[model samples]
Target: MTEPLQHADHLLRAEGLECERDGRTLFSDLSFSIVPGTLTRVEGPNGSGKTTLLRILAGLNDNWSGQVYWCGQPRQKHWDLVRRNVLYLGHRPGIKMLLTPLENLQALVAGRQQVPGRVLGQALEQVGIGPWSHVPCGQLSAGQKRRVALARLLFADEPVWLLDEAFTALDVDAVAAVERLLEDRVRQGGAVVMTTHHEPAMQGMRRIRLGGAGEQGPVTRAVGEVD
Candidate 1:
């Protein structure tokens, strides 16, 4: 709405990002750019803080110290603009279990956009859970609950997506569906930064590997084989 905060090339960029949790140093001097039309995988062992890093990128965590630039400027100076253009999906489904699947989705897009009920239903259908849309999420299976969360991807208008293990618990079909969705978004000039154990079916994915020994810090690589 406000002409997208005037970016030269990158949609999001982090410079010298450093953070620690429980006194464990997660990363240091971590710099990267999330440009349009690319898929970035945050690769790391368990407890390596992939989720923590995603939170920082999405503005959900402020415990970290570093400069995150939204559209090539400091995040603090234009955080509101940053918030508007990014869609974040945490590892948890984040659905209100007491609410129906439809209701959960309604709440997701409520303040962000004026999505109609029919459109919302279509999103559920696209994710292969339309029949269960009216049923409470508490009654849904693990995979179904994940699908409900995945449904939001269908209608989310945000250009930047920060997904944490988004493919977990999904069936083969559902995983493929989400893969297609990611491909579509990237083709349309959107950027996605995600963490997943499942190897993505999509090609040309860059990776940021965390943990292990390095004189400088954890390694974040781009478009190449392991070094």
Candidate 2:
């Protein structure tokens, strides 16, 4: 007898979500579903609420109205569970300038399972900054700093990845490395959602655009038929 294939779980669902700041609507009536084994890109022009949507997905912006579901349940009903399953990386490379790249990785992964030095070295090599692993991040180039921040993704074991402009300051090789990492995650039944001004390099990914006078509502450009 042959074993049955396991279907990827729906990691996130947003329905009728509305966000506002100081009485100005950022986005409203936004709806989408993200499943494991896929990458969903949120693309739009400047001031179009891409970051706002990412925040809502990450549960960092709780003021929004409507529902966000995780694993088919309301996220609010199980905040801890949702948070544990998701990893959000913002536009800023959240690294301590004083710390070496290896030290920063050590601090971030200290409490979790031990991060092997070989794995850390491999991740740094993937981003083409392996040679500078011992250098303080403040002394590195802007692109190198960005790569150091991105190294956290490799150590994070979450199922969902939320990145805002992840490619910012990345060189060509770094961009390719990031894309490969994302593709590998999807292949292993992980989900990804990100905001980017430029289209991502990954193929078969979904794209959503936010529009309207106040960034109200989203229009799907290209997506998998079911999502």
Candidate 3:
């Protein structure tokens, strides 16, 4: 397991985040802190800008105004650090259709580190794609393609993860597998901020409900650390 970040505070924090689109306000004064060893669920009805909020936190969107801190430093000043360490998984499977799952994973960790083929294959097997690891991703079903993307979670050494609707195309068993992955990440002292409609069986995940009255995301815990 990867070691926890060395920070003495929240892994990531946002203050007074506000974003507007199409001449309408999506959310205002939103704030949250992602504590280590915890999962934060960004919840709201469709079109409430949960994805947008995540993008802002991940530094993928620049159209918003907010005070975002990474390891207690302003994110804008340390953008490279944030981008390098945080793994942002979008709603769609972000993989090349023409490449095999192994190839896609190779490209993902290309510049950072060299991984052995055996390790890559083990990651695919963990995600239930071992039987089709070498098949071109274009020929895989939707869930399989998502599994290809999900495999990166196994290779993640980052302290922070931003997942936008990662559960969208997964089946029951696959979703359960992801939940276990989340559990593992937290156990490794990582922080997770995700947007998903699926009610995870793992409990005590803090909720950030957008577009509601006074719903600015806060760092309040409903229970103790995840079991």
lDDT of each: 0.84, 0.78, 0.80
Native-vs-model 3 lDDT? 0.80
C-alpha lDDT of residue 177 in model 1: 83
Better of 1 and 2 by TM-score: 1
Best by lDDT: 1
Model 3 agreement with the true structure over 1-227: per-residue lDDT tens digits: 44436534677888888888776677877777887878888877777788988888888789988799987888878877788778899986459999999999888777655778888899999888999988999999998989888888887777789999898788999998899989888877788889998788776677787753235633222222342
What lDDT score goes with residue 88 in model 1?
92
Q: By lDDT, highest first, what's the ranking? A: 1, 3, 2
Candidates in order, TM-scores: namely: 0.92, 0.87, 0.89
Please write out the lDDT profile of model 1 over residues 145-221, one tens digit for every residue. 99999888888888899999998899998898899999998877788999998888787687887874335555544
Cα error of candidate 3 at position 17, Å: 0.4
TM-score of 2: 0.87
Winner on TM-score between 1 and 3 is 1
Each model's total of backbone clashes:
0, 0, 0
Candidate 3 lDDT for residue 124: 94
Q: Name the Cα RMSD for model 1.
A: 2.7
